[model samples]
Target: MEIVPIDTPSLGDRSYVVHDGEVAFVVDPQRDIDRVLAVLRDRGARLTDVFETHVHNDYVTGGLALARATGAAYHVNAADPVSFERSPVKAGDLVEAGEAMRVRAVATPGHTFTHLVYLVESAGEPPAVFTGGSLLYGSVGRPDLLGSEHTRELAHAQYASANRLAAELPEETWVFPTHGFGSFCASAPSAASSSTIWRERQLNPVLTRSEQSYVDEPFDAYPAYYDHVAQLNLAGPGAPDLSFPRRAGTTELRRRIVAGEWVVDLRHRAAFAAGHVTGTLNFGIDGEFATYLGWLLPWGTPVTLLGETREQVARAQRELARIGIDRPAAAATGRPGTWTAGPISSFPTARFADLARAWQHRPVAIVDVRRDQEWRAEHVAGAVHIPLHELPGRLGEVPGGEAWVHCNSGYRSSIGASLLAAAGRRVVTVDDLFERAAPAGLDVVSRQVMA
Candidate 1:
């Protein structure tokens, strides 16, 4: 038996292909299934089944599409309130695939009420379980991700569910989870990609914490896009529309901008800061584009692409697809020279040293667009904290002054600076190391280490 981990690094999610010689089964596929098919081809195995741990809230699932393409049975929780047809799987149900590969469904409801973990073993080999967004490598999946009302009930369920997995599964049983790393779905990040049941038992605090305290895990804020994703998944967001968006001409692109369509500029930070189409969002093609772009783009809002090449635009679309962000209204390639009527707008960018020297003479509002954890670790004493994803909606919170934006890295700060500029604010980006805050003559504030 062979189990392969297919990673979607942008979202920090992993799907798997477990096969025994001739037949294979896919777990929690992303919307783009070409790689999954390619893996099958490489292994010379026929895909016979597709398993969904739950109706995912993070991204669109490619289970239905894969099943349809490969003529495989799609398996999901029997209790889920999804509209699409799926082979209902219940706890303790054993399923057979290929000559020796066998799967046992273990319902684990901490992550989602209908979540399941599949334990796959073949011909007396030790079992490996696919724990999708349930029990991760270090910390377990967050319970409050669903909502406030369901948080208490689901937190208790998650505790019991975790303890059950530890008690029932053998120590040597291999564990594979879909969320960890940088995924917001995880309670905390893990150092490793995969772990054994024994390792998780020894390290994970969720299994050891009191139910009440664990339930009280304070959630700062979830992405606004998350509010709409669950409903779309429940309604069975079938397959992404196969038709590619049309290429927009200069006239057409300008019209879309006038129509209030978001134009995502996928150039690098330096290039974007140097010059870009005014009001176009600067989530570069080279950075953590998927997560932030998915978080920031309002649901069902039409988007157009402004990139350097057709491949660049298509590459952006590919990353967006992993997060269920399809339906790009149109794409406009190349630099703004031919695509826009007005000259490209450029913003002033500063390194920490220059920012420091200027801060002594003029009080510039420092905007830090990192996550809550990053902010708590260390930040410039009086810097305003609005995460890049939240900046579009919460622009009012920023103080009125000459604004200088910076995240841990320059990438996010550049994006934030662009947004601030587009909103008619006077902004410049501190496009350098965040640690330079102190040397730059700013009072550095440090908070408690994240749990």
Candidate 2:
């Protein structure tokens, strides 16, 4: 028996394919099931079971279609309000995979009411538990995603869930959780990906802290897309639509933009800022493209992708499909000469060092377009704290001066600078890592800003 980890880097999600010679089970798959299918094919294994820990709030799950395609029994929480038929499993239920592997459902509710952790017992190996969101490496999943009113109740439940798992499982059991590695679902940032039950009990802040302190712990602001993802996941997300987008001429692209659809330029940030089609936004495919695009895009609204090459746009479409943003109504990919029409726009970018030097000669107001939790942790002494999502509505709050904008790694600040430029605001973009500013002679301030 062996377990393989498949990392979906865009969403920081990890799915597993646990196999025992010929039979296998897939756990918490992402919307794109191709990777799981490929793994199964490579191993010459038959997929017999598809399992989900909960109704996910960050991205759609492809378990239903994967089960349908492979004739596997789909297992999910019985209490979840999903429309599709599934083999509902509750606590204490054991699922047999093959001669050497089995899965045991353990009710561990905190991230959601119906959450479950699966304990896997395989031949010749120590027992390991798929903890899901209940117990993570350094921290646990946040409990308030269901609603703000459930914060205290869910936090208390989380405490109970952690204790229950620790008592039920042996200290040598391997702990695997789905919500940690660079994901917003975690209550605290994670330092590692995998841990043992004994190590987690010794080092996990969520388990060691007092119940009230853990409950009162602040959480980062969830993206607006999370609300949409929750509803779609519960209703059973549709299969990925792999059709190529209709290549838009200049006219159709303009029509879509005029009709309130956005033109997303998926080029590199530097190329995008140098010159792009006016009114289009930049969500470069270099880093976590799907996650950021899913967060910013309006649900069901049409979007046209503009990239420097055809392959770039196609790669972006594949990434977007994982988050259920498929079938882009129009796409344009070519050198700027073949594609863009009318006046192209550009924004001036400055380095943190340059901005710091200029700040001494003149008082500048920097726009820190990061999440509130990030801003509160550390920021420039007098930077404005408007998150990237709220930039449009709160544009007026940015005081007029030598305005400079930046995010942690400069991805979001590029978007913020474009929006401000489109709104006729003259601002210099600090297109550099915000954390690197301290060594570059910029004064940094830190605080425990509760979300």
Candidate 3:
């Protein structure tokens, strides 16, 4: 028996392709079915089953499309209200894939109301459980994604569900989870790349803490794009069209920008800051390009991609498709100078020391655009707290002056700087690591100081 894990690092999730030599099954695939298909082809395996732990609140699922392509039976929880035809599975249902693999659907209602973990048993191999969001390596999936009304109930359920798994599963059982590897779906991040039921029992707060304590854990805002993904999943998303968009010229790029459409530059942040087409926003294709772009860009707005190469544009297109932002309206491949005849706009990129020096000389507006939890942990003294997702709507709240924008890393600050610059505010992106802020002599304060 072989289990291959495919990771989508930008979204911080993993999909599994498990096969007992000839027959293979998949769990929690992303919208790009091509990757999963390639894996199956490489193994010379035939796909027999596809399983979804829940109606995902993150990326659009590729289950329906993969099933149709490979003639595999798609298994979704019986309780989920999905439009597409699926082999509805419930608790205690046993599914067989050839003679070597036996999968049992165990209902684990924590990540969502209908989440299930698929327990796979094969002869000589250790038993492996695909614990979708119920029991993560260290923390369970956050319970607030559904809504506030369900948060409390789901939080309590999450605790019970985790305990249930720990109590029933053997110590050596391999625990595989779909969330908690930097996904917002997780209540917190897990440093472990892999874990076992024994490791989880020793380290996971969910198993060790009281039910009331687990329920009281706090959550922050998730990506705005999350509001649309679940609906798209319920409606049954098909395979993404990853073909290159129509070529866009200088005139078209200008017109789109003037019309308030998103014209995203897919270059490195440093290159973007050095020089970029006027009015184009920077979402460097090298970083978390799709996540922040999908998080900030108004849904359904036409987007035109500008990349340094055709390959960059194609890569960006594939990333966007995972989150259901299909077929970017247009694209161009070249340097910023080639995109516009007008003067290329440029911004100053700096370190925390630059910011500190400027602050000492004169008062400057510091916008801390990290999340609420990050802000509460530690922040520069006098920095205004405005999470990046909220910045587009709260522009007026920023003090009228030059704005120094930053996040934990410089990638997000570049995005924040671009938005501020586009809105006609003078902005400088602090492109250095946040760890340098204190060493650079900036007045940093902790949550205890604020309290």
Candidate 4:
């Protein structure tokens, strides 16, 4: 049995293609199905099955497309009915892969009513479990992700399901989960991708707690689009009709950017601040890039991506497509000619030392782009506060004039700077000034850590 991991950078998602001899099964595939097809063809394997662990709420799934293209069966949970053409899979249902491999569906419905984990049993090795959102590396799926009323019940169910798996699987059984680091499915600070049942039992916080304790833990509210994405995943979207022409060069990108198209910077926040195409918004791949982009920009806005590297461009395109942002005009090569307005000037950033000195001479407007809770605890003296999400519409509040912007890190400041610059205000970004000032008398403010 051979397992290949396919990383989708746009969504910070990883999918697996498990092949045993000439038969292949794809697990939790994002919208880009061509790559999976290519891999199957190269291995001379005929696609036999596409399995979804659950109806996902993050991005569109490609299981239906892959199944239709290859005349393979699409399998999903049987208990909770979905709209797509899928065979109902319940516990003890065994799927055969030639003579060496067999997959057994295990109902694990805490994440969703229809969630299932596939237990793969080979001829000689300990069985490996494909735990989707039900069991992540260091965390279990958040129950509140479904909604408020069902949160406690689902969390309790998830706890019970996790406990059952921990007790049933042997210590050495390999665990492969659908989500890992950077996935919002689990809360922040998750561990790496593969872990053993023994490791999770010893170290996972969720595993240590009782069902009631797990359900009682407080959590932030789920995003608005979660239900929409979940429904789309259940009834898979049709094949991507990405009719947008492939961008040829910087010249074409600039024309689109000027024509009201959104230019998404897929680079890290720090890299974006160092230098980026003028007028472009930095939606780093780490954050909810696709969802936020859809919210901030008008729908169907032709997109051009500023990826970290050439290889990442396709990943970015697929990511946007996963959220239904299909018309990507092109990927930027970080060349000067890409921007018709030339390069947008970097915001004038100043250090705390420089800001202190300047403060003595004239009033320098300091805009705190941190959250309201952050502002209430501790912030720069007399600084105006505006969260980055609200900055675009509240530009009038920022008293323009050599304005200096700062966030916990420079990411938000860079975005603030772009909004201010687009509105014709001179701005500077102070990166990580909060972290740097934490040691000093400067009171760093956060919900968890109050100065």
- The segments of candidate 1 whose C-alpha lies over 4 angstroms from its true place after superposition are 208-210, 242-244, 448-451
lDDT of each: 0.83, 0.83, 0.92, 0.73
Best by lDDT: 3
| Least well predicted 10-residue stretch by lDDT in candidate 2 | 335-344
- Among the numbered candidates, top TM-score falls to 3
Per-residue lDDT value at 291 in model 3: 86
TM-score of each: 0.94, 0.95, 0.99, 0.81
Which regions of candidate 2 are displaced past 4 Å? Answer: 362-364, 448-451
> Over the stretch 9-103, how does candidate 4's per-residue lDDT look in tens digits?
44546778888768888888877788788888887887788888888877778888888988988887776557766877888899986677898
lDDT of candidate 1 at residue 64, scale 0 to 100? 81
Over 4 Å off, model 4: 79-81, 221-227, 241-280, 284-295, 298-315, 329-338, 341-346, 350-403, 407-409, 446-451
Better of 2 and 4 by TM-score: 2
- Give the C-alpha lDDT of model 4: 0.73
Candidate 3 accuracy as TM-score: 0.99
How do all the candidates rank in terms of lDDT, highest first? 3, 1, 2, 4
How many clashing residue pairs appear in each of the predictions shown? 0, 0, 0, 1
